[model samples]
Target chain A: MKKYTNTGSKDTRSGFGAGMTELGQKNENVVALCADLIGSLKFDEFKKNHPERFFQVGIAEANMIGIAAGLTIGGKIPFTGTFANFSTGRVYDQIRQSVAYSDKNVKICASHAGLTLGEDGATHQILEDIGLMKMLPGMTVINTCDYNQTKAATLALADHHGPAYLRFGRPVVPNFTPADEPFVIGKAIMLNEGTDVTIIATGHLVWEALLAAEALEAKGISAEVINIHTIKPLDDTAILKSVAKTGCVVTAEEHNFLGGLGESVARVLALNNPKPQEFVAVNDSFGESGTPEQLMEKYKLNNQAIVEAVERVIKRK
Target chain B: MSNTQQLQDFSTQVRRDILRMVHAVNSGHPGGSLGCTEFFTALYQQLLERKPGFNMDGIGEDLFFLSNGHISPVFYSVLARSGYFPVAELATFRKLNSRLQGHPTTHDGLPGVRMASGSLGQGMSVAIGAAQAKKLNGDKHLIYSLHGDGELQEGQNWEAIMYASAKKIDNLIATIDLNGQQIDGSTDDVLNLGNLKTKFEAFDWDVLEIKEGNNIDAIIKGMTEAKSRTGKGKPVCVLLHTVMGNGVDFMMHTHAWHGKAPNNEQLAVGLAQNAETLGDY
Candidate 1:
C-alpha cells in the first residue's frame, strides 16, 4: 500500500464533542442529555460551559430518550449521547415509540460503535444497531467518519427536525475529509475518482477505502472511493451512478454485513442496476475483548480484506 | 361557556362524547376514560389555568400529560369539548388515515397530544421530563400526569418516582388512576400492586388519596390541593380511587369492560345513564 500521509489521527468522539461545544455556543435551545457517558462521548466541555443545558441523566438511557422527547415539546433541540448498544438496543422501544414515531427532533448521538469499540467486548459493541434503527419508519441513520466530518454531522443533525441516529466510534483513524465540509443527510461524498470499480465505505472504513484505492492505483487499476455516511436513506442516485460508471462495487463498514450499508447498497443495485458487489464487514459472530486493530483483522474489516474484495468484484464484472 | 350551568353541561357532553367515540370506533379503551371523566373535565375546564384553544408550546398556564394514554377517548373528548379541535374529528377514530388511532399519537398533528403513548410505562418519565422543562423555563405553573395503578409495576415508573423525589422535583404533580384493574382481571389478581400509597410514601412522595375519584367536587378539591402542594421541595402524588366504569351502570365495577366496547343496545343504555347536556357529536 502506498503510504500517502500518516501525520495525524483523531478519535471520532472528539468530533462529536467539538461539534456540541460549537452548537452550545451558537444555539441557546441546543441541549445535551447523556447516560453516564459524558466523558466517553467527549461532552465534558459542553457540560462545563453550559451546565444548565447539559443533563447528566446517569446511566439510564431509556429515561434519557424519554426526557429528550419531552424537551422537544418546548422547542428545544436535544442531543442524546451514549454507547451504540445503550443508545439503540437497550432503548429500542423507547426510541421507536417516543422519538421516531412521535416525530420528536431528538439527535441520538452514539459513540464507540461496532467491534471498533475494542476492549469493552461484544456486550458493549452493538453490531445490530444500524439494522435496529433503520427498521424504524422515520429515522435518519448517519455513520460519520473521522474527526471533522463527525463534528460537522453532529452540528447538522441539530438543525434537522425529526429523530436521527448519528453514530461514531472509539478508534482514531485518519482525518482526511475536508475540515469544513458541510454535512448533508441522504447524500454520498466521492473522495477519489476512478473507472475500474467503486469502493464505498462509512465510519472508520472511509480512510481504509482511500488506502485501498491508492493501492489499486499502484497496481495499474483505478478505484473510485465513495464515502456513504447516511445508511438509511441509501443514496440511490449516487450508488447507481457510481456503479454504472465503474461496473463493480465494494462496500465496507465496521458493522455486520447482514443489514449494514452493504446490504442497503445491494438492495438498491439489485433492483434498478444490478452489478458485482463485495462486502467488507463482520460475519455472523460476536466480538471478543481485544485491541481495536486485532478485532479489525479478526473481523476481516481491514484495508487488505477490502482490497481483496475489490479485486474479486472486478473479476466478476 | 360562561355560566355554571354551561360548565356542568360541558362535563355531561364530554361524558356522552366519550361513550359515542369509543362505540363508533369499536376498538377503543373506555374503562379508564370513563373512570376519570369528572377529574379530567375539572382539570381542563375549571382547574387548570389554560386558554380555550391548545398551543404546542403552552406557556404561562399549566400542562397535563396522559401517561396512561389508553384513555384517549376521555382525553380527546375533553380536549375537543374544550375547543382544541373540531368535534367531528372524534368520529375518525381507528379508521385508516384517521387522526385518532387506537393508541394516542401526535403524528397526525393532533393539537392536544404532545407525545405518542401506546406502549405503556413511558408516560411517567415523559411527564416528569415535562415538569423538569417547566422548571427550566422558570414557569411557576405545575405539570400534571395521570398513570394507571397497574402500570406501577413498570420499572420506569419507579425510576421516575425515585428520580423526581431524589431531585426534589417540586414543580411537578402526578396522579395515579387507582382503578385496581388490568385487562386480564382484577389488579389484585393480575399482578397484585400490593399497596401503592405506601409505595409512594416509601419512595418519598407527598401522597394524597382521593376517596371518590369520580366526584367532580372531590376531583376539584384533590387537584387544587395537589397543585398547591407543589413548589415545596417535593413532588406530589394523588392516588385517585376511581371506579373502573363510573357513570354507566351495566359497565361499572367489572374488569370485562376494561377493553370491550359496548354493544349497540348497551351503548343506548349507557348513553341514557348520562344525559346529553351538550349536543351529541
Candidate 2:
C-alpha cells in the first residue's frame, strides 16, 4: 500500500487566488471578473496587483458572464470568479448563449461548491454545478481536490482554448498533491494500487478516499484509490482498467447522487462493463446549515462511508 | 452616385432581402428587421471604419454586435452585402448547417458574428467588455451594438448600463430600436420602459435620439453625431424611433409581424414596396 501525507491545511480558494496572482504576472491577456465576492473568492491579491485587468462587477452574475464572453472577441482570456450557485445555476442561460454555444474562451472559476460550503446551506452550496457545466458542449469540467491541485488546475485552465468550469470549496483541507505537480485536464491520477476493490473519488472526497483505502487495508482488503479531478471528458480508460482489475467499484463525491461524478461513472460502466457499483453521494436531497465537519459526517461523505460502500460492493462482487 | 444615394440603394436592397429571406422559411422576425434596414445598411456602408475581411479578434476595426438578434434578417443581409459572406448564401437563412441561424450566433463559424445573442439583455455588457478590451490593447477602435426597446425590461440591461457608466467605458455606442412593440404587444402595454432618454441620462450615459430611424439620411446623421460623442469619458446611447414595420404598409405600426413570417401574397406586396435597387440574392 502506498502512503500519502498531508502537508498542511489550506482552503482551495486560496490556491485559486494564488494561481490567479501568478497568471496576472505571467499572462497579460488574462483578465479577471468578480461579481462582488472578492473577499469570499480570495481575489484580494490578484485585484490589488492587476487593478487594470480586474473588473469588479457589482452583484451581477449574468452581466459578468456576458462581459467575460465579450472580452474573448478582442483576444482576452477572461476568468470569472463567484460562488458555484451563482456561477452555474444563476447564469446558465448567459453561459450557454454567449460562452458555450459561441465557444468563447472563458474560465468559470467557482468556489464553495457542494455541501462543504458550510452554514450557508442549500441556497449557496451548489452540488449540481458539475452536471450543468458538463452537459454544455465544448465545456471542460474540473473539480480539484486540494490546495495544490486547485492552484495547478487554475494555471492549466489559462492555456485551454474553450469554455471551462473549475470547481473548488471554501473549507480548509489536506494539502496532499505535489506543489509543482503538472495538472492535466481529463486525466485521472492514481493514488494507490490494489485488486480487491476500486474507489474512485473527486473534489474534497478524494482525500477521504485515500484514508478509506488505508482503513480497508487494515481489514485485510486491498482497495485501489484513483483521484478523478476532471469530471467531463472523464478518463474512461483509467476507470475501466481499474474496474477490470477489481470487479466492483465504489464511487464517492460530495454531491447529489442524481447528477454528479457517480452518475457519470455509472454511465461509462453501464455502456462498457456492467459491474457491481455502490455510490457514496448525497441521495437526492438538499443540504442544511452546519459546519463542514458536521455536514460531511452527517451526509456520510467521510472515509467511513467509503469503507462501508466498499464492504457492500465486495459482497455483491 | 452620391454616398447617400448609394446607401439608400443598399438599404432598399437590404429591405428586399429581409422580406424574401424570412418569407422563404415561413419563419423569422421581419417587422423589426424591416424597421432597422436603414440603420443596418447605413452603418455597414457609410458609418463604420471596418477592415476588408472578417476575423474573430477584431483588434483594429470597429465592431458591431446585434443584441436584438431576433431581427437577424436585416443583419444577415447587410453583413453579406458588405462582403462578409456571399450574397447568394442568403437563401440558407434559418436552414440546417447554414451559418445564417435564426438568431445570429458564432457557433457555425459565422464570419460577422462575434458572439451568440438570442436571449435578451446580454449584448450591452459584451459590447462594454469589448470596448474595454480595445482600451486594454491600446487599439483605438469603437464598439457598436443594437438592442430592442422592449429588451430594456430585462434587469440585466440596467446592471450593464450601470457598470458601463461607473467604469467610464466611453468607446461603446449602444442603439435602441424603439419600435414601440414587443412579441406580445406595444412596449407601453407590455412593460412601459418609461422615458428611455431620461433613464439613460439618469444612468450617466450620453443620450441621443433619432426621430426618423427608418430614414437612411436621419440614421446617417444620428450615427455620425453619436460617433463624434465617443472618446469623451461617457458611453453613448442612441434611441432610434422607428415604425415596427417601416416599408411594408400592412405590417407597419403593429407587433403582429414581430416574429411571424409574411405569406406568399404578403411577400409579393412587401417586395413591391421595396424597389430592387441592387437586385435580390
Candidate 3:
C-alpha cells in the first residue's frame, strides 16, 4: 500500500477563494457573483482583486442564476457562489431552462454542503444537490474531497464549457492531494490498492476511506480505496476494475443514500458486475445542529463506519 | 412606400403569419402573438440596430430577448421575416425535429434565440446580465426584452426588477405587454398589478408608456424614446398597453385566444381581417 501525507488542514471554501483569486489574475473573462455570502464563501480576495468582475447580487439567488446564464451570452464565464441548498433546489428551473437547456457556460460553485456544514442545521446543509445537478442534461457534477482538490476543480471548471456544479464543504479537512496536480473532471484517483475489499468514497468521506484502509491493513485485511471526485460521468472503469479484484464494495459519501454517490456506484455494479455492496451514507433523513465530528460519528460516516462496513461486506463475499 | 406604411404592411403580414402558424399546429398562444405583432414588427424592422446573421455572442450589436415566450408565433415570424432564418421554416412551428420548439431555445442551435424562455420572469435578469457584459466589453449596444404583464406576479421578476435599477443597468430597455389578460382570467381578476408606472418609478427605473401599443407608429415612437433614455444611470421600462387580440375583431377584447388555436372558420376570419400585404409563408 502507498502512504499519503496531509500537508495541512484547511477549509475547502478558502480553497475556492484561493482558486478564484488565481483565476481573477489568469482569465479576464472569468466573473464571480455572490448572493450576499461573500465572507461565508470566502470570495473577499477575488472581489478585492477584480472589483469590476465581481458581482454582488445581494440575496437574490434566482436572479443571480438568471444573470449568470445571461453573462455567458457575451463570452463571459460566470461563476455563481451560494450555499448548496440555494444553488440547486432554490433555482432548479432557472438552471434547467437557461444554463443547461440553453447550453450556456456557467459554473455553479456551492459551499457548505452536506452534514459537515455543522451548526447551520438541516436548512442550510444540502445533501441532494448532487442528485439534482446530475439529473439535468449536459450538467457536469464535481464534488471535491480536500482543499487542494477543491482549488484545482475551481480552476478546471473555467476551461470546461457548458454548465457544471462544483460542491465543497465548510469544515476544514486534511489537504492531501498535491497542489500542482491538474484536475480532471471525470477521472477517479486511486488512493490505495488492495484485494480483500474495495472502498469507494467521495467528498469529505474520501479521507475517511483512507483512514479505514489503514485500519483494515492493521487487521490483516487488504482494502482498496478509490476517490471519486466527479459524481456524474463517474469513473466507472476504475470502480469496476477495483471491485473485480476485491469481489465486494463499500460506497461512502456525506449524502443521503437514496440519491447520491452510493446509489450511482450501485447502479454500475448491478448492471455489469453483480457484487455484494454496503453503503456508508446518511439514510433517508435530515441532519440537525451538531458539531461536524459528532454528526459524522452519529450518522456512521467516519472511518470506523467504513471499517465495520468492510468487515461485513468481506464476510458476505 | 414610406417607412411607416412599410412597417404597417410588415406588421399586417406578421399578424397573418401568427394566425397561420398557430392555426396549422392546432396548439400555441395566439392572443399575445397577435397582440404583440406591431411591437415585434417595429423592433425588428425599424428600431433595432442588428447584424445580418445571428450568433450567440451578439457583440457590438443590439440584442433582444422574448421573456413571455408563449408568444413565440410573433417572435418566430419577426425573426424569420428579418432574415435570421428562412421564412418557410415557420411552417414547422411546434412540430417534431423542428428548430422552433414550443418555447424559444438555443439548445437546437436556433439563431436569434440567446436564452430559453416560456418559464416566465427569467428573461429580465438575462437581459440585464447581457447588458452588463456589454458594459464589460466596452460595447455600447443595447439589450431589449419583452415580458407579459401577468409575468410580474412571479417573484423572480421582482428580484430582477430591483437589481437592474440598483446596478444602474442603463443599457437595457424592458417592455411589458399590458394586454390585461392571462390564461385563467383577466389580470385584474387573477392578480391586480396595481400602478405599474409608480411601481417601476419607485424601483428607480426610467418609465414610459405607449398607449397605442398595437399601432406601429406609436410603438416606433415610444421605443425610439426608450432608446434615448439609455446610458442615463437607470434601466428603462416601457408599459405597452395593448389589446389581447388586435386586428382580428372576433379575438380582440378578451383572453379567449391566449393559448388556443383558432378553428378553420375563425382562421379564415382572422386571415381576411389582416390582408397579407407581404405574402404568406
Over the full model, what C-alpha lDDT does candidate 1 score relative to the true structure? 0.86
TM-score of each: 0.96, 0.99, 0.99
Please state the CAPRI-style docking class of candidate 1: medium
Q: TM-score (0 to 1) for chain A, all models?
A: 0.97, 0.99, 0.99
- Per-candidate local distance difference test: 0.86, 0.93, 0.94
Candidate 3, residues A47-124, lDDT tens digits: the string is 998999999999999999999999998999999999999999999999999889989899999999999999989998
- For model 3 the TM-score comes to 0.99
* Interface RMSD for each of the candidates: 1.2, 0.7, 0.5
lDDT of 1 by residue, A15-86 (tens): 999999999999988999998888899999999999988888876778888888887777788899999999
Best by DockQ: 3
- Residue range B1-281, candidate 2, lDDT tens digits: 23888888888899899899999999999999989988988888888889999999998999999999999999999999999999999999999889999999998887899988889989998898899899999999999999999999988899999999999999999999999999999999998999999999999999999999988898888999999999999999999999988889999999999999989999999889888999889
Best to worst by lDDT, what's the order? 3, 2, 1
The sequence of per-residue lDDT tens digits that candidate 3 reaches over residues B135-235 is 99999999999999999999999999999999999999999999999999899999999999999999999999999999888998899999999999999
Which scores higher on DockQ, 1 or 3?
3
Which runs of model 1 end up more than 4 angstroms from their true locations?
A1-7, B1-8
Ranking by TM-score: 2, 3, 1
